[model samples]
Target: MTKGSVRSANGRPHSTTGGRPPGRPAHADPSTTGGQMTTGTTATTPTGPAPLRRPQWVRVLLVMLRALLVQSLWFWVWVLVPAAVAIVLLDRFGDLDMSVVQFARYGGIWYPFALSFIGVGIQFTVHVANGLTRRSYIRAVLVTTLLIGLAYAVLMTAAMVVERAVYTANGWAPYTSGHSASLVAGAGSLFAATALAFTAGGVSGLLVGIAFYRGGALRGFLALPLTVSPAVVVMLLTDDVAAGRDWTFPATVSTVPLTAALCLALIAAAATAFHLLARSAPVSKGLATS
Candidate 1:
């Protein structure tokens, strides 16, 4: 075809320039760094197994389930062995008085510590890439976190029950009436505290992961105070190690119920922050790709 010819000599053009006609508007489809045209529109590609068979929300739920599974595996593989070893060692070798319930009481805080940093950030990137809205991803994460908290609470309560049975059979004392006044009492308190703290930690973790993923080091460090505030609130409510070792408002709200309420409120705030961060979530480069 001639340079200015509208039609080729044989009445057909030979060059295929990505479906674009010659002299097309530059603004219509700008060139990417890789020379690909931007679609500039949404494309719905379902994710998860059997994408054609399941609804999109069900896929979201499946992703949430996977998230829960990963968290549970981390708990059992990474957190459990060390915890059991420490419990046994402390009970036998260390002279300090101890109970398994005390360790179980603090298990909720570790959930966020495990999930909030590197893992969830990568998950956010993947979920977005796989055609999930940031809104949906955050919601799934929150739901999954709640389930993790509830499952751990149930597990801890069952462990307490078994511990009580063994202690009763062996004629040994477990704990003498503090937060855990009796075995049943301990289970109730631990279950409630664990569930609350786990949910709060999950929320805090979402905030931390999103912050670090978006802002790298500077914003992540700046977000520390806000991102960790939910866990701090949980610590304030449940931990009685020292009065002033960490931030606490026990002077104004000393009761467990009040403290729990405060923690939930903080978790809600963290969730809001998470939504804000994830709405504009960006894909990041990683070693795996390089």
Candidate 2:
């Protein structure tokens, strides 16, 4: 019989004077549990979000290519329409001494100026599409412009070759000096020259983009000078060269090297200006006016 059950008629089990069962864990105080003690050891802290990455070159390239393709299409239409009209007018009148080749050459010389306008359009479109930094956009523009200029030079040279062949086959002598060799060399030179010009222009456009991002409508006025300065210098030098005059110091520079040097200088100046402009704050007053 149990010790407590010997004298008690009730059937309940007796307490063992404050002794607990074997292997049972101790109980925590209810007051301590209320005061902020936790059972788990590890605490979970939240982390901040990661930064957004810069865009890839492929994305930038695609944006640039699309702008170029569209601009080129429009450019072609612009060239063709005027040419067709001119051809019709000439045919209606007496046949002139000028061949289609001559007309094409004249048109091609003016085409670079036309491409400047296209460059502006490309700048605007690229800004809208990529939201790229001014520098990145400028790089993309320069690359695209170089590619377009190269392609144009190649096509123009090929056309000249075909024209020469046709003229020869028709018993007309090609009158140009160093016609075949010049065609090849001139194509290379023109491509280089155009690339330099485009790079200069792109640098100028980058300045404009920065100005626009900061100064808005007033930036347009600033942009005109930046974009036109290279052309102005080039035109002046070319005019002097044509007149057989040497305007620069040292007085003995070759036309090609002088022109290339001037272009490179303009590109450098424009790039420097762009760098300075990009670092400055955007002009809120100008934006407000716009």
Top candidate when judged by lDDT against the true structure: 1
Give per-residue lDDT, candidate 2, residue 286: 32
**What tens digits encode model 1's per-residue C-alpha lDDT throughout 177-197?**
333324433456656766777
lDDT of 2 at 113: 51
Most TM-score-accurate candidate: 1
Q: Please, what are the lDDT tens digits per residue for candidate 2 over residues 207-232? A: 55555555657766667676557545
lDDT, candidate 1, equals: 0.64
Candidate 2: residue pairs that collide:
214-283
| Candidate 2 whole-model C-alpha lDDT, 0 to 1 | 0.50
lDDT agreement with native, every candidate: 0.64, 0.50
Give the range of the ten consecutive residues with the poorest summed lDDT in model 1. 240-249
After superposition, the stretches of candidate 1 with alpha carbons farther than 4 Å from their true spots are: 1-55, 70-74, 77-96, 104-107, 176-186, 240-254, 285-290
